[model samples]
Target: MGKGGESIPDEEWERFLREAEAGVEGAPEEPSARARMVARRLREESGRPEPWRGHPPARRQRGKGWYAFGLLVAAALLVVALDPGLVAGWFGGGGGDGGSAPLAVESKRPDQPPPTEAAARRPTVGQPFRGSPAAQWGDGTAGIGLPEARATGWMDKGQVAQALEKSRDFLVASSLDPGVLRGERPRKAIALINPHQRDVQDYLATAFRAPSRENDPVLLFSRFDRTKVRLVGDVVKTRGRITYREGKRGAVEVTTDVTYVYPAVRAAAGSDEVVRTIVRREVVMSWDDPAKVITEPGTFSLVSYKADTTNGGCATPTGYFTPEFGPERAASHPADGAEVDPYDRSKSMETRMREAGGAGCGTATRS
Candidate 1:
C-alpha cells in the first residue's frame, strides 16, 4: 500500500508513484565520510560495485497510503460483522448465486497487492542492503587488507572499475599491524628479488678478484716481509627486496641471498699463513633509497650474520670502506707480538690473525 514502504502521505504516494511510472529513476542520497571510505575499499578489493555504493540514504517518504489501507481493511471486516446476513451469504457460496457472483466469489482483501518474489528478496521494509565489492574481485585483489578499506554507498557498475585502478599501484613493504592476528586485516604485502645464478656469479667475481685490497707488508721469520699479503678467493651474488612497513615508507624491501663457492686463500699470520673459513650471509636491502639506506659499508649493514656463523664468510651491518676511508695497515709483524696490523689491524680479524700467528704476547692492539 505504501510505495516501497516509505513514509509518503497518501496524497504524496499517488504523486510519487505517478512520477515513477513516468520513468523517473530513483536515486539514493549521498553518505558520510566513514561510510564512503568503507564502501570504496569494499568495491576496490571486490572488483565490482556494491548495490549501495553511492545511493540515497533511508528516510520515510510514504505513510498515508498504508495508513488508509489499514483502515479500509479494518472497515471491511467491521462491515462483515455488522451485517452477518450479507457477509455470511456473500462468503457462503452455495447459498445463492446473487452474492456468489464471480466478483464476490473471488473476493480478496483490497488494501494491498500480493507480495512478489523480487519484493521478498529486497531489503526488509526499513533496512538498506550493504553490498560488498569483494564478492566480485576475489583473489585479483590479493594484497588488499579487507577490513582496512572503506567505500561509499549507492555505487554503480563503473565505480568498481575505478577501485581496481586505484589499488593496482599500491606496494606494502612491511606489515606491522597487530590486527592480522585478530582477523582484523587481511593479506600482508611482501617484496621479493628473483636474481639469476649468473648474476650472483658476476657480483662475486667483482667483489673478490678485483684486486682492491691495499698492498701491505707482512711478518716472516720474525721480520716484516713484503711478499706476505691477504689472499682471498670468493664467488658471491646479491639481490634486494622490501621486508616490512618501513621499507615501503620510502623504499622497497628486498632479500638478497648470496651462495658463494669460495676457494682457499692464504693470509699472513705472523710467522705462518692460513686460509679463512668459508662464509655465508643473508642481506636485506631496500629499493627506494637503495644506496642511501642499506649495505653501503660503515653506515647500513653490508651483511647480517642473521642465520650463519661469522666464519661462514658472512658480512654484518658494517659500512663499506672505500680507499679514502682510512690508511692501509702494515701487515702482521712478529715484533708487534700479535700478527695484528702494525698501523690499524686491531679489528676482530686483525687481532685474531695476530694471535693465531703466535705473535700476540697478549698486548692489546687498538684498531
Candidate 2:
C-alpha cells in the first residue's frame, strides 16, 4: 500500500499510531511492583551493550503497516523539499515539530550544599572567608562611618566619669542593688548547686588563680596572653573574691567584688605582670536564661548587649548599642567637627587633638 520497500522505525510508527488512534485513557498510577521492577531493570540495562565488530545486520520488519507509512512520509518529504514555502505556511512557519512551537528549554544547576562554613569565614564573620581588612573594619564597626566621633553632646566626659565612679563605689554601698542581680549566689553555692560539674575546679583554678603560699613574693602584673600566663615563674600569690551580676543589659559579668588581698610590684612605675597572675579576672559571659521585661531607669535604660564574638573578637559584634541608635560604637574619632587650634602646631599635639575631638569614634571621608 505504501509505494516503498523500506520500513519506519518502530518508535516513530508506535508514536504515530498512538496519536492517530486517539481517545486513549490516561496512564494509571501505582503501577504493579513487578512492572516497576522490570522498568527499572530495563533502564539500567539501557546503559551498555555488546560492541559491534562489523556492520550490523539490518533490523527485520515486524509489521507491514510501518513500510506503508514510511513510503507515505518519503513522498511527503519529497513534495515539501520541492515547495518549502508552502510546507511552512501549512505547518505554521517552522520545521521543528511541524511548526507547533518549540518547547521552552530549561537548564538547572545541580544540587549544591550551602556555603555556610565558607561563608562564615568571609571578609567579616558573615562572609565565607576572612574579609579584607577594610571590610572587617567597616562591618565590625557596625556601619559607623569611619572618622566617627561621639555625636555632639552625646556623652559628657564629666558625667561618664561620675557614672564610672559610682560603678566603682558600688562595692562600698552598704546594701546591694536588689532586683538587679539574678541567679546571684556565692561561689560556694554554685558548687552546691551543680555538684556534677567535675570541670568546675579546673575552671576555677585556671580562670581564677588561687593563692598557693601565704607569702609568694610580689610580682608586677603586665599585659600578657591568658594562654601563656600559666608558664610564668616567680608567680605572685594573692587572695581575692569575685561576684557575678546580671548586667543591666542582660549579660553575666563577673566582678571583683572584694580583693581581700592581691600582689603588686613595689616598683615606682609599676608594671603589674612581671610574673602576672589573674586575681580578679572578669569573664563577661552571656546569660542564656529567658530575658526579663525590665523597665530601665528613666535616665539610663537597661539594655541587652551581646559580646563581640564576630571577627574573632578583633572588633565588636551585635547587640552592643543603645536602643535608639543600635548596639555599635565607633573605633576611632574623626577631626571634622573638632577644628585645630591655631596655637598647637606641634606634631606631639596630634594625639591630644584626636582625644579632644571625641572619646570613642572613627570616621571616613565621603567619596
Candidate 3:
C-alpha cells in the first residue's frame, strides 16, 4: 500500500525501484547545480542544525526495502535535477503549458479543511492551489466585491459610491498589485490618500524611507522579497467586503476588511515548493463633507489601518513578508501567541487582531 493506504501494483513498484537504482548508479561524481540546489532545500526542510560534510553519515543495518526506498528518493531528486521544468510544472508554471495533470478544485466551506487526504497533499506543479482555502476564491480584483452604495446621513449616493470605488482601488494597489507584491513602492495607493492628513503622510513617508518594526511598510502594503521568492501564479486569491457608514463630524467612513493569499516559491531556478502567506488588512478611510470640513477634494483621509499576517515568519523585520515554507521554518521562527487560523474569515478583523495580540507574531493553525 502507498502512504495514503492506496493499493500499489507490484509491477509498478518494482519498475520504480529498478529505475531508481539505475539512476543512482549512473549519477555523476560531482552533483550538478540543480542537484546542489535540491540538496540544500531538502536539508533545510529536514531541519538539521549541523552542516553537511562531504561524505554521507554511517549507515545502520536496515531492511533491504528501506535501503532501496532511500535510493529511490535520491533518484527522484536526481530526476528533478535533470529536468528543471518538472518543478515548474508541479507548481503551475506561468504559461500553463506544462503537461502535468491538474488537480480538481475541491469544494468545501471557506473555513473548512480539505475533505480528503489526497486533497490535503502539498500542491504539485499542475495543482498549485491544492490543499488551500484559496483554491475556490476569486482571483485578484474580482474577489474584492464592492457593496451597494447608498446615501449616508452626510454624503450623497454619488459621493458614497465614489468613496467605495476609491477604497477598492487602494485595496488593489496595496494588496493585489504585482508591482507592490514584488516590493516596489505603492505609488498609486499612496496617491489615493489625502495629503491634508499630515500625520498619515508623515507615517507613510517614514515607513517607506526607513522601515522599522514600529513603522513597517507591510502594515499598509503586501510585499515580498523578490530576490528570495517569486509568485507561483498570476492569481492572488482575495476575499473580503467593503462597507461604508456615517462617521463623526458628518463624514462617510469606508472600511475594507480583506484577506489576501499569496502562493510563492523560491526564486532559484530548480526550486518548486510553494508556500502561501495570508494577510488580512482592515483599513478605514473617511471622506469629509466639503462644506463641513476642509480636505483633499477627492482623496480620502486615513482613519485607521490594521493587518494580521499568517505563515509569515515571526522574526520578519525587513518590511517584506517572510513566507514560512514548512514546519522547520516555523520552528525556527517561533511565534509568541496562540495558533490562529488564517482561512477562517467568520470573525471580524478587529476580533482576529485582538486574538493575535496586536503587532506580535502568532503561529497559524494552517497555511
Q: What C-alpha RMSD separates each model from the true structure? A: 34.7, 28.4, 20.6
lDDT of each: 0.27, 0.27, 0.74
Which residues of candidate 2, in runs, are more than 4 Å off?
1-42, 45-367
lDDT rank, highest first?
Answer: 3, 1, 2
For model 3 the TM-score comes to 0.67
In angstroms, give how far residue 233 of model 1 lies from its true place.
5.8
Instruction: Report the lDDT tens digits of candidate 2 across residue range 48-68.
Output: 643322354455553466788
Report the candidate with higher lDDT, 2 versus 3.
3
Per-candidate TM-score against the hidden true structure: 0.17, 0.14, 0.67
- Give the candidate order by descending TM-score: 3, 1, 2
What tens-digit string does per-residue lDDT give for candidate 3 at 18-109?
66668866545555444466577777785554443345445554466688999999998996677654454466532123333433322222
Model 2 TM-score, all chains together = 0.14
Q: Model 2 misses residue 28 by how many Å?
A: 16
The candidate with the higher lDDT, 1 or 3, is: 3
